[model samples]
Target: MAGRILVLNTGSSSIKYELVDVTTRDRPARGLVERIGEDMGRLTHRAGDGPPYTRERPVPGHGEGLEAMMEAFAAAGPELAPVAVGHRVVHGGTRFTEPVLVDDEVIAAIEELAPLAPLHNPVNLTGIEVARKAFPGVPQVAVFDTAFHRTLPPEAYTYAVPREWGVRRFGFHGTSCAYVSRRAAALLGRDLAELNLIVLHLGNGASATAIAGGRSIDTSMGMTPLEGLVMGTRSGDVDPALAGYLARVDGLDAQQVEHALTHRGGLLALTGTRDMREVRARDDDTACLALDIYTRRIRKYVGAYYALLGRVGAIVFTGGVGEHDAATRAASLARLERLGITVDPALNQMDTTGERAISPSSAEVPVLVIPTDEEWEIARQTHALIS
Candidate 1:
């Protein structure tokens, strides 16, 4: 608590670390270790008010990646002693509702939930284990991406699946949604309990959650991150029978189909690229279709959640695509005039720097674009746990 809090977000093949001074809200250092287990791994480390230090070397595993991160801090600047380490673990299943100090039981629970998040949890566990080893005395807290959504009502979380499969909607982007929703309410000068919010988190992996009175009442994703709006590469929603159909026709197994849906579908399947910026730049029919599919899916969720919320006070956009892509934002909410949602062309197209509303002057619902701060939230939580 007396020192900095280091937050680690371990993705499938990347490690994102941030060292924050919780007392001052100052990030003394931050970096990313990308392309792990590859021939050439890259690390970009930066300390406060300094040029970033860059390195390209072979990082064979998450442990090596973390060691390189430590080296970066040693060589660059900021002393690498953290009082606590916060990890962004992707799945908590039904056990974790808040950040918990990692122990063997917590590790076992995370491992048990790996089947639900095959792409994230295992790698996240690797980071936790490695960090535990590297800083044996430091308190390491596991902050779940699904934890905030634990407040989801039964109706919203329950899937219409066979009860025996033990499957249900476990929404992602909860941390981002939590931070933005709070910020949106504060910006509007309204209490979160009195507001109905539609939160669209459109990063590489996208989701739409309907928050009623600061709690998730409904969300777009179900069971896995693959069941929501169109994302960078993952297919958001598809027919359940498609897997069986593919198996019958193309000899694809369930896992193979799941992999395709998780990695090869969505924008990549529709167009030649996964980035929305790339898709927006093309004038070809393929890119046009991809954009349509992406925005249309968002529109559908907006409509569905609007009906669910009955009276929505605000529509918030966060994450990479939501914050940056003006065209996608405009197109996604284009036909919601009846819902009193409209974006001003001037404001929407302008290159605004930080959190700001983009709705039309007379629009009933405030359409806001709040840049998410998940790392800050993770750091805060980690600091709180240690203190």
Candidate 2:
């Protein structure tokens, strides 16, 4: 707890690392290794407040990505000797409800959940294995992205599908949602227990969750990340029969359809691009349609969860697009005036840098934009484990 905590958020093709001073709640250094397992990989490292250090080289795998991160810290400032290494493991299933120290058995459990999250869990375990070897005896903690939603009630999580499939809604982005929703309560000067919040996590992967009395009552993403709002590359929802129809008509297998839904679908499929900023910058018809699809999906969830909550204290927005894109926020909440949700145009349009309420003064439900700090949350949880 006295030393820095190294928080690692490893994706299939990237590694995001931060050296956080737990006591001060400050990040001394942070960097990203992007496009791993490909040619022309890039590493951008930043320390303190200086310019970022950049490198372009081939990163053959996640192991190399970790090595590059270490090299970045060594070459830059702030020697990296972490008290603990916190990894952001995607699918913890029902086994891990909170951050737990990783052991061989835990690693095996994560591997067992791979079928539930084919693209994420396997790669996540790879990061865990490589880090365990690289950092030797350091305490390694698995801070799950799904951990925060473990409080979800049975009715909310159970899917309508046959129970034999052993599938249920295991919400993603729990770390970001947990961090932002708690911060939302703090920002509003209210106790989280008394607050009913609808948290919208919009990024490459998006989800909406209803936090009733500070526990996840319901969420948009179910069973898999592919079940929620439109995402960057994943199709959020589709007709149940579409997969079988594609198999019969187009000679596509179940795996092929799943791959497209997981990889080539969503905003990328609707439009040529997936990033909201890119879509917003374009004035073409396709871009406009994609934006409509994205925001409409968000609006539906807001309305659905609002009904479920009966009384909403706040509608919180976080993640890449939610935190930065004001236009999307305004557009998504525009028609909810009857629900007491209205954003002040001037406040919403302002170039704000931190958390702030954008809802109109007379609005009943406060609409807030909170920047998410998953790395800080991971570091805090890891520190807690050791303490």
Candidate 3:
């Protein structure tokens, strides 16, 4: 656990990996196997600062994808032996509250929870199974994205429905939240217990989490990732009765409605493109409305979380869109001066980098941009568990 820990984030069709030396927080090697099961797949491995070693081939499955990773490390330079292999499992569903060493029981549990995260847990298990086989004796650990949100109080996680149905909010993007919130406390020079934070993890999949005393008190994502903020392709916060309505009128079942909302809704359904940059690039009315809808949802969440926490020490933004989209950072918090939360236009729009505040110096609340690193968080957790 003290040595190199290989972090594998297995997606539906891609496997993202990075080798972290827990002692130094450095990635001696990193790579991705994308377009798996497709006619052609690509693996790009970076060992050092020099040019990356790239390969193009057919990666039929996760097993072949991992084998391709081994091939990359073997040919590119860094000997691919890891002290432990850490995996990113998307959902814990109250069954797992922390990182667990992978075993047959763990694998079965992950498989069982696939009903909660049909698209993620299965592939995550595949990575664990393949890594166990690939490394033979190396320890395999699963660091769930939902584990960090286990601290949610009963009220925060409970749903107002039939108790026999058995459902509650299980927030996602917890790995990112765990890392960036700690970094936020460090940047503010305050103990995490003393800070109340609202973390907006806006990426392809977005969520807003309220963290008090370094614990998740509430989150936007509910029983599934589809219930939160509008994402790249997901329509968040839809009417609960839509499924029944569609079934009655259009002869569409619940599955069809879910499929459309999960894959074809959001920006894609609104603006013909899922990319925020594309919507931001155009001045057309359609694009303008899309941006407004997106940013407006974020502002609503911020206001709600602020009311929930009563006092927010900082608003942290992380993930691909959150960290890079200056326009979003500004628009989301627009017209909130009454709340003593205001972004410094110059500072917010500046071409700066790394953990930094964008709020006006005199503002009561600070807005920050802290890029998330889930790979390192998994490696850190894995190291701690095995150490």
Candidate 4:
């Protein structure tokens, strides 16, 4: 129970592993195996103070990638003995409302829910499978991204569509929201159960969640991650008729339309690039329009969630884009002064690498930037299940 917990976040083409000591909050070793199926794959492993152990070679599959990770741990340092392996499984659907110890039945259940998250669950399963072979008998826990939003009220999660289709909102970024929201409560010197929060997790996949008394009352994402705010590549809220229109005129199928919406929409469709930093750096008309579209989506969600929460104690921004992009933080909430949401220009624009408020002291709703630590959350949940 006192040892390290290995957290594995496997993507379509990458595996990000971190060895975390929950008690001391220290990451003894952390690294990535990127471009897994590519001919030129890379593995970068870090342990102590010196340079990270790096490897560049063909990683034919995730199995090979996991083998390489084991090799890195063996060669680098810190014996690869983890108390538990925490897997970040993207969509648990309605079946898994909490972290469950992984087993044959759990793996089958995760596979059954694959249709809900075709891009993520399959790869996440691969990580689990590979880890089981690597560390036999070690407990592996599946920490769901949808678990935190299980607190969503029926009204907030229910869709207006045919109930027979079994479609409704199941928000992502729940893990990040859980961590940041609790940290936000601590920063404010209040209990999480007493605070009303609107958490904006902005990264490749962005979402706005309204947390009332520490419970998710509403969130932007619905049924799938593709329904949230405009993300790096996903088009958040598209007209339902547009896909039908495309099918009729362009001979595109539903899967094709979904694929385009998932991989080629949003900033990529607007500006030919998915990186937000690149979009903000350029002052061209197209880039400016893309920025406007992105921030406008976020601003709309803020207003909508504000109305839902009735009163917000704090608006916490987390994830890569939320923590570092001061311009985005400012632009998203620019003209909301009437709603008691105003960011102090001096504080908002300053470059700081800590959790701090950017809103004016006199503002009714304080706006904060809290960095998310999902790895720690995963490890904690995994530890709770096993120990």
Best by TM-score: 2
Question: Model 4: what TM-score?
Answer: 0.96
Residue 334, candidate 1: alpha-carbon lDDT: 92
Judged by whole-model lDDT over C-alpha atoms, candidate 3 comes out at 0.91
lDDT of 4 at 138: 92
Clashes of each: 0, 1, 0, 0
Q: Which digits, one per residue and each the tens of the lDDT, describe model 2 over residues 304-382?
A: 9999999999999999899999999998887898889999999999998699999877789999999999999999889
lDDT of 3 by residue, 296-336 (tens): 99999999999999999999999888998999989999998
Clashing pairs in 1: none
lDDT of 4 by residue, 110-178 (tens): 999888888789989999998998889999999999999999889888989888988888998888999
Worst 10 residues of 1 by lDDT: 272-281
Clashing residue pairs in candidate 3 are none
Local distance difference test, per candidate?
A: 0.90, 0.90, 0.91, 0.91
Error of 2 at 126 (Å): 2.0
Cand. 2 TM to true fold: 0.97
User: Each prediction's TM-score against the native?
Assistant: 0.97, 0.97, 0.96, 0.96
Candidate 4 local Cα displacement, residue 224, angstroms: 0.8
Candidate 2, residue 63: lDDT: 82
Better candidate by TM-score, 1 or 2: 2
Candidate 3's C-alpha runs over 4 A off are: 35-40, 57-61
lDDT accuracy of residue 265 in candidate 2: 94
Worst 10 residues of 4 by lDDT: 9-18
